[model samples]
Target: MLFSEAQEAFKKHLIYREMSGETVKGYMKDLRCFNRYMTDVYNGAIYVEDITTDDIEEYMHYLLDERELAPRSRNRYLFSLRSFLNYAVKKQWVEHNVASEVDPVKVMEEKKVALTEEEIDELLATIKHKIVKFSVAFLYYTGMRVNEAHNITFEDIDNERNRLLVNGKGKKQRYIPIAKSLKPHLENYLTNIRGPIDSPYLLATKKTGRLSAGYINYELHRATKELGWDKNVTCHALRRSFATNLLRKRVDVFKISKLLGHSSIKTTTVYLQLNENELQTDIDKL
Candidate 1:
């Protein structure tokens, strides 16, 4: 089968397997770039059977030398191609997945940035957009992924119970405890900012009805730039802050793991990026 035909089949396979829309989009984008490289450099349409391991390696070189993509970004491209080739193999279009033979770029482990409470307060104050403010605050207090937050509806929020029913990854449902400080933030947004919207989503705007991850990131970037902050302050940063703050408060790692809805406690530990002073203070105590 042609690589293009196989790419379409892989896309449908991804969707049918219930992958997130963003995940599918990312995979398709990487595959399309690979397809373009084949057409432009290899001089024509390439069949899945004709693809070689060398072709995949040369593509990686193009991404590194020509496109100047970072190791992490280049790895994403390689992974997408590897996944597509795997799909092609399953469909019997190819004898094997040649993309897998290519070694991925080595990425150094960069520590995640977790916002301090003061920094969180300052960022929130700098954000003039009401929905964006609420969204950031919600992530901080609840430790929810921006996508999980986007999925929230009125029915999911239980004011009386003081918890939220989060539809998490893999369609798993988990209830996140609503912090007392966050109660007012939620109440105010629902009562004022999101007042009587036709959409059922908790973070509805009059223009788009429901908020998108793109808009949230764009607004967040703008706010961070305005504050003259040079760090990578993202939606996931808020969630990391939640985990680290909980750890500082002497919360059990197991409990924090559950709160973050991580399948493993090891994953939660990665988010606990305490500052140097905090590390010193804890060491002194010991």
Candidate 2:
């Protein structure tokens, strides 16, 4: 089949697999770019079976040298191609995914910024919306992604156990211990703020039911701006702060990784941001 035909089929397959609309759109955009390259360079509609690893490798160079795409951006294009070819393989359009044989551009790991505990407190106080305030607090204390915190039901709160049953990425469930500092606020929100809402989610507006991840980040950003702070604080920043604060308290990285529900400890380390003073303090202790 032609690459363009296979591209359309792959798009439908992505949607069928329940990928988000934005994600599917991005994949299609990348695939369309690849198809355009094939059409221009190969001089016609190219069959998927005729494409080889060398062709994909050459395309990577085109993205880098000709298109001047950054390694990270170029890698995204390669990733999109890899996903498409993988789908094509599953559909028996190709014997193998040649795109997989091509190496992605190396990207430097950019350290994520985390808010200090004091900054978190000030930001939470700045948020006027009760739901948004509680959402920020929940993310900071629980180290949950915005979606995971939004998905938390009343049943997920095991108050008797002093921990929460969190449904994390990929439908995986884990328990996170509630900090003593957060318990009072959680209780107040549950008793006074969220009591009237009939929604199952712990974080919900009475009219809208469950709050969206975008809304959560928007409120957090607004709160940060209100504080006259120039930091790029978001819901994910709150989560990073949680990990960083725990590390400051000398918690084991492995334990923190489990609490954050990260698939790898290495992923959890990316969330931790300790300043030079903290590093020196640790070194001094030794």
TM-score of predicted structure 1: 0.91
Please give the lDDT score for candidate 1: 0.89
Q: Show model 1 residue runs off by greater than 4 Å.
A: 90-92
Tens-digit lDDT string for candidate 1 (1-286) = 8889888889899989888787899999998999999999878998889889998899999999999999999999999988888888888888888988999998998878888889999999999989889999998999999889998998998878888999877667899989998989988987888777799888878888888878878888998899998887888988999999989888999999998889988888889988889889989987
Model 1, poorest ten-residue lDDT window? Answer: 189-198
lDDT of 2 by residue, 1-286 (tens): 9888888888888778777566788998998898899889978989999989998898999998999998999999999988888888889989899988888888997667798888888888899989788888888888998778878898998878988999776567899888998888898898888867778888888788888889877887788788888778888888899999999888999999999998899899888899998889889988
Clashing pairs in 2: none
| lDDT measured at residue 117 in model 1 versus the true structure, 0 to 100 | 88
RMSD of each: 2.0, 4.5
Candidates in order have lDDT scores of 0.89, 0.87
Q: What lDDT does candidate 1 reach at residue 48? A: 82
